[model samples]
Target: MEHRQLVHFLAVLDSGSLTAAAQRVGLTQQALSKSLSRLENELGGKLFERGTRGMTATRLGESISEYARDIIASAGKLRHTASAALGLERGRLVVGLSPISAASLLGKRLTQFAQNYPNVRIDVEGGIDRDFVAALHRGELDIALSSQVGGQYDGILLEQVFSEPWGVGGCVNNQALQDAQSISDLADGKWIIGRNTDLLDDIIAETFSNAGLPMPKPGIMTTSVLFSLHALSQSDFLAILPQSLCRDFNGILWRDLSDGAWISPIYMMRRRRAHMDELVSVLLRELKG
Candidate 1:
């Protein structure tokens, strides 16, 4: 019933022999054998059956193995949680970022977070809106910053931090769109679209569709803000960019679509009842500020 005895049992089961298990667990073969024997005695059952081939788990052993794994996993988690609580373990934070947020403010927030919590390791993964949300739901991300697509996450909480209007962006010196007044006016220009979720593309297409104009096929689809900006600045391609992002990019001129305004709400997602670690709370404050 001892933790070490359970570990020794699992090792022997995995290695197929006492000698191999002893070597792996850094114990003498006889010592490991005795430990297993003691464990079986304590549990009032035989754990393993020795045969010509190798050691095999008995029915009782098989039943116990499942519980043993859970016990060991829980013990490890307890140790980690305690260490983190005591500030003995340098924590790790995994953040998921949507493409637009990455372009506007994520980098600055990360820089400031790093300066504040130098001991905590921070990992940033960038993806489109859907992928980021999926990662958050699957527990692969500690937090996610992305646009709010109305949906319920049963055990997750979403906080709306800010809302920004969408705007049409193209080359600064594009003569073809100088007097563009509406979505219908941009019908002849090629559109540059961001891949994933298609939020921007859908809005653009809807604008043209509602205005009785042909929806322009996107000439380029990308997740990279830099690539999208480069394409917009050097060619006649227009992209729907968040107004905040347009403001961040000094040289970009944004024209509001007259069809109606598209407002994208930025949200912070985290597990609902989960404890917010100290570093995470600090980072959230910085983001909200």
Candidate 2:
């Protein structure tokens, strides 16, 4: 229950032995063992099983270890938050971003935000749209910039910031892509596709299905914008990318879908009840601007 006890337990779990944990924590082995014993007494359970190789956590220990880690992390965050609130000039912001949006927009805004809020530490995680949305709901992220995939969340608020047009991109000189106009025209061409649940992939799949074409054979599937671009640049495969992504790539040629517009509506989403701190607000404003 005590912070020191939790720390000792976590050290043992991580180091896999009381001797190593003691050395890491700068305590004698006896002291570390006493601390573990006290913690076990307080919790009424054995935390570890000793073996010739190392210590292993029991089921209850494994469950509590996760909680202990979270508790320690949350406590540190709270201390940092309190310091910032009291004008101590120290804070942290965790922002989640979709990979494509990170490459296209969030990366720049993040740099500017860091320059503006020099005292605030920023951590960024990039993934597909669904993972970003799920992180927002789990309170793991302060804010996120992602393409809208499904309906708005009841507990989260989203503000539309921008709409980016999507286009098919391929090697600039791909001979197989000559005179391609519609989605079906590229059906037989090798395709680099985004993963399922990715906003761009969902849109591309729907467009192809609506055109009564079989889904293009996926030569590569990726969540990384850079990887997707790299694959397109190296091979004769085509990929759907944001207009902004292909604008500066002379090695790539973009062709708009002929049937309908494929636009990804980008949103800045955060939990509805969560307080928007100054740093988060500044980042959001910079993104919107």
Candidate 3:
């Protein structure tokens, strides 16, 4: 019911343990339990089911967590706004980066931002576009840099930043595929594909279908870029990777496809609000600059 109770509840939910949550929120375990108990009584339902290992949220807890986050974030934004008006800085920032951004220089910028704003707490998370957008809606992320994805983002806005081209990459030392210049040329080649790339899958399928070629089955499926790169080194498999990543990695070489260069448009995604937070504005300036 109180702001402190909600904060404690979130801490426990996030840490999944009473002792850890208490430590995180600077409260004793017994005190934290009392807060939770009072909250559950006010709400008339058990928020979490405790077990020997850790606590797990019940159905009510799962649904209400996002609302709690938004409420807490809104309250913090008010404080941050007041601080900014006095030429001071405060509050937390959670940023979500796409796979390509994670592989590029964005991470270094994050470090710099954290160092410059010592009063702020920043958390960086890595995931694909949809996942990042979902985090934004849940108030888990303040800003997200990710590839463009198609969906009904009712309360989200996407601002295009840049585009990264994709290429079919193979081992640099593979002489057999040296003369291959397009997707058709690698018709019979094995592929190492990343799984759970929903939009990228559509692009790949459409590109091959336009070339009058059926979509090739992946020889190896994974959700890791490192695994794909290592597989290319060990086998005759090809993969579609960000040109920036391919250009720098030794033992990897890429060629332009005759059909089209799959363009991954990177966007700055966030939940729509009446006014942007000061930390968000500062971080955007740093990234844009």
**Each model's TM-score?**
0.60, 0.64, 0.71
> What lDDT would each prediction earn against the true structure?
0.71, 0.73, 0.76
Residues 141-229, candidate 2: write the lDDT tens digits. 77777774566676778888777777788888886565886777776788787753355566776787888987787788876777877
Q: Score candidate 3 by TM-score against the native.
A: 0.71
lDDT of 1 by residue, 28-143 (tens): 98899999999999999998899887899999989887687566555544543653685613777778777666655655777787777777777888654445444444344677
Worst 10 residues of 3 by lDDT: 79-88
Backbone clash count, each prediction separately: 0, 0, 0
Q: Using lDDT as the measure, what is the rank order of every candidate, best first?
A: 3, 2, 1
lDDT of 3: 0.76
Give the C-alpha miss distance for residue 157 in model 2, angstroms.
Answer: 3.6
Over 1-289, each residue of candidate 3 has an lDDT whose tens digit, in order, gives: 7887878888888778899788756799999999999999998899999898799999988989988978876765665566466442566777888778766556567778888888887878876666665456545677888764665476888887666677788898776568876678788888887752467678878889877899878888887888888778767888888776777777888776844547776778887862476677888878765
On lDDT, the leading prediction is 3
Candidate that beats the other on lDDT, 1 or 2, i.e. the better one = 2
Q: What is the lDDT of residue 143 in candidate 3?
A: 82
- Best of the two (1, 3) by TM-score: 3
Candidate 1 pairs with clashing backbones:
none
Candidate 3, residue 202: CA error in Å?
3.5
Clashing pairs in 3: none
